[model samples]
Target: MTNKHSERRVVVIGGGIVGASIAWRIAARGQRVTLIDKGEPGSGASSHSFAWINAGAKEPIGYHNLNRRSLEMWPRFATALGEDVGLRWGGKVSWETDPVAAEQLQARVQQLQSWGYPSRQVSAQELAELEPALEIGPVVAAEYSENEGQVEPQMVVDACIRRMSELESLILTGAEVIDFDRDADGGIRAVQTDSGDFEADTVVLAAGTDTTTLAAMSNVYIPQAESPGVVIRTTPLPPLLHNVPVVYAPPLGDGRREIHLRQCADGRFMIGEGDQESLAEDDTQSHADDLLSRAAQYLPGLAEAKAIPVPVGWRPMPLDGYPTLGYTTETPNLYIALTHSGVTLAPVISQLAALEICEDVRADAVLTPYRPERFATLTEEQVAEMAHPRAGHR
Candidate 1:
């Protein structure tokens, strides 16, 4: 393995939010760093996401805690980047459209409260008072978290790339890393790219869905769950939904999907995840109208949201529907950071993982329980046996 004590040269594959953030953090610590992207930085799944920095959205107290840590780091990260990534901390409102969903929402509120995050239920009257324009359904209940927020995904990538370059880190665009070569001792030496051979003391694969292919190059199989969802941006409207806004409708239980409606700072309200389909691969974009049609069903107010611009992307879904984050057991220097919540946790993970790489520490201890390698360790039989342990696992 390359000596951590020696001056290090690190190459990060995939220049999305995670990769760029990692490169920025590593270079900020005075290390030699290079970030390579096949296309433009953050133009991939990073920029295509909902762009919400929601700490309380995660289920299970552990996920919430991880998000809380990320939440604490976000302010410092935004200030350090010193650019307006359209970040807003106006809080979020999550709602349900079924009595059962209301019960579940009540339970989730209790869970969030137990974790010391302030989330409380709001009545239909309170909900109406909060947003007079919102047309609540017959079975609507809401839980509001005051600290949640959103950001423009593209702006975040732009700021991080500029900051990484300013920190003197090599930012390589349009460089696709096709393969990686590891020496006899299991150390990554050179990454074979379309351009040429690029060498580094360490390699971190934050390649989003492509991480699976890169790990396969290293003979490691990482389980991936891909979900294709739609996001529609409406024409800029008046500040209809105030603060960090979100609306949720319960699953009809007919194998359809639930809804998470969000309004962005740019006067665009994005409706997504109403017709969740389990994605087979991350090879193609999804059909936008399928999701948009579903959104129109949940939100009667959406009929008036004009000129909706639709975009579709895949969120890396682990088998458990939670994020799989950590380094591989077979390769010490080969690190993996795959999560749908990358936007929310980009700054935190970058800061923590950079500390681990630069300081010779394993910050993976924090997220070790959720390691991608967990799937690697399980036999095919085991995975088949334990599939879908939790309802609405996402």
Candidate 2:
């Protein structure tokens, strides 16, 4: 990538991890960038993120490879940020108590191994030795995904913002986007924000839940499913899991979901049940306490920890359960980036998005499956129904 786009102005809406990463990447590549956020950066869905960077759970060979590519780029990406973004790589471990679930786990591991991922079924002894802190209940079967890991989303966002500042990019917080100014051909000419107006050659809407509404202003349709998740935190405790960075303990009984636990760099444990994009709406103190107590069934050390209930955070879920990326047909210069695994996919997504915006090249090879135009045919009633549980649109 050269400085050919040095004269092009890039305006990024949304200051979450995705937007921040794209802003910094665009700015660093010599394009003039303006980052606009309605509130403090990284204070939205990112704050409530589990921050577990992984690819094992992703499906479909292409999408899995996309996440795996970004996962591999994390270390170098963190290095480029010039700060420790609390990236830790010890892999993810999970076990099952039920025989049926154990069979499912075995098959999952086999499929991952066939994909060349470093995932394999581990014995009960190996699982115990891997994380001696965990009190293995009745492990009928278990597996370890060695390539998966976790990171600090806020630290990653801050690092990107710092790099953008060093590149002389402008950042506006608490600046809601009121509207957009269109050019003769109907491309975004400028962004009208409460903070002020910012002219742009390219406008990237990476806003979390608001991406749909913002894109609709330009006649671009992007539908999203309601994804409310809760990942409660515990009061900062001493370093808990020594070897594995993440643990997926089996449910206590028949009617429970699998609980995931990971100790942050600050020693606070983030406990959440279900997959990264699973819909969990409970954020009450009782739910938080129950989550912690269930985690304690595996990691006895957490028995004394107090659960801190966080508000239910709505994840940015494209209707099809994949990323909505690249330029739209209605607005060629308007880029749409909305995804469920933004934290894990940030590195590769930002780099490719910057390439498309800066060099005037399309990343169709990797991003063709996630174009915003895919959602162009939805009916008015469908659009109305899919917009629920969304945060304020900019």
Candidate 3:
């Protein structure tokens, strides 16, 4: 399809992985693209992300399908960017020890299997064979999905930005978007940033947590929940297991927390807790210690691993706990891209968003469920009703 706005100027706000991907893709299509960020690119949520590239545990079949499609596109996407973003597709291993949680895990695995997803329950022996380093304490059930993976999110963003520079796309840092300049017809004509105003035919708000604030400048309301999360990075250690991501949800009691751990390409292990207990405004030491202690139970190697917590960051989750993509009705030229799994969805979302913007085609068929208009008239009760069970501060 030929883009009607092939020669138009595009300004992408937010230099994280998603914005960098969009800017690079648009520039590749022969458009004049500019990328602006309030600080260094990928220093926000993208830097501190768990960076697990997976579709294994996503709920609502449609969301899972979207993630699966993105996982399929990641390899080519990484290759095109021409750098190692620490992309590893060793898959994932997860288990539950409690009977109730084990039953839930079985049902979830069955549901995934019914959806044609390559996920299956594994026996204790199979689990051992998959990850020898893990000490499965009374594992009632376990599963392994060969389709999951992980990435170094900061590396991906840096690679995309480097390619964007090679493409001669303008990149501005420390330029905070303050407002939008609109024409009489209510179409965006330019973006007003703290640095200055830049003219553009289209403006994309890919800023993670700041998306809502920017949308309001164009008279658009994008409701987002405040979900803060932290990731603890340990010093580089010997290879743990076979380079696979491991998720363990032990029996819930005595402050035991769900653990997510994966070794980066550089040999450093990234660990995160799934709990949402709030911490002191400036204190993450206690939380980091809790996470390391919990992980040490399963992997004794982590017992003495020094815990270095990454910067605290918040996920840009919509009210319904799903991605919000596509343009707005009030401002036709203003586009939005927000989600919790930014690392997993960056490539595909960027491709689809670029198509919609350049070709003047609506991707409603594929993105209908995640359109931003759903929250236009969304009521308080409706938001409460749509709250996801797993949706928490993180």
The C-alpha local distance difference test score for the whole of candidate 2 amounts to 0.89
Tens digits of per-residue lDDT for model 2, 1-394: 4475578888999999999999998898988899999999999999999998888888888898999999999999999999999999999999999999999999989998999999999999999999999999888999999888999999999999999998888989999998999988889989999878899889999999999899889989888888889999999888889989989988888698999999998989999997676678889999999999989989989987899999999988887778888998898789998988899999999999988888889888888888887678778776666555442121
Q: Which residue pairs show backbone clashes in model 2?
A: none
Worst-scoring 10-residue span by lDDT in model 1: 276-285
Q: TM per model?
A: 0.86, 0.95, 0.93
Q: How do these models rank on lDDT, best leading?
A: 2, 3, 1
Instruction: Please give the lDDT score at residue 137 for candidate 2.
Output: 82
Q: Highest TM-score, which number?
A: 2
List, residue by residue over 183-229, the lDDT tens digit for candidate 3: 99889899998899999999889998899888988888888876667
* lDDT minimum window of 10 residues, candidate 3: 274-283
Would you list the rank order by TM-score, best first?
A: 2, 3, 1
- On lDDT, the candidate that comes out on top is 2
Clashing pairs in 1: 225-317
Candidates in order have lDDT scores of 0.72, 0.89, 0.82
Cα deviation of 137 in candidate 1 (Å)? 4.6
Residue 158, candidate 1: how far off, in angstroms? 0.9
Indicate whether candidate 1 or candidate 2 has the larger lDDT. Answer: 2
Mind sharing the TM-score for model 3?
0.93
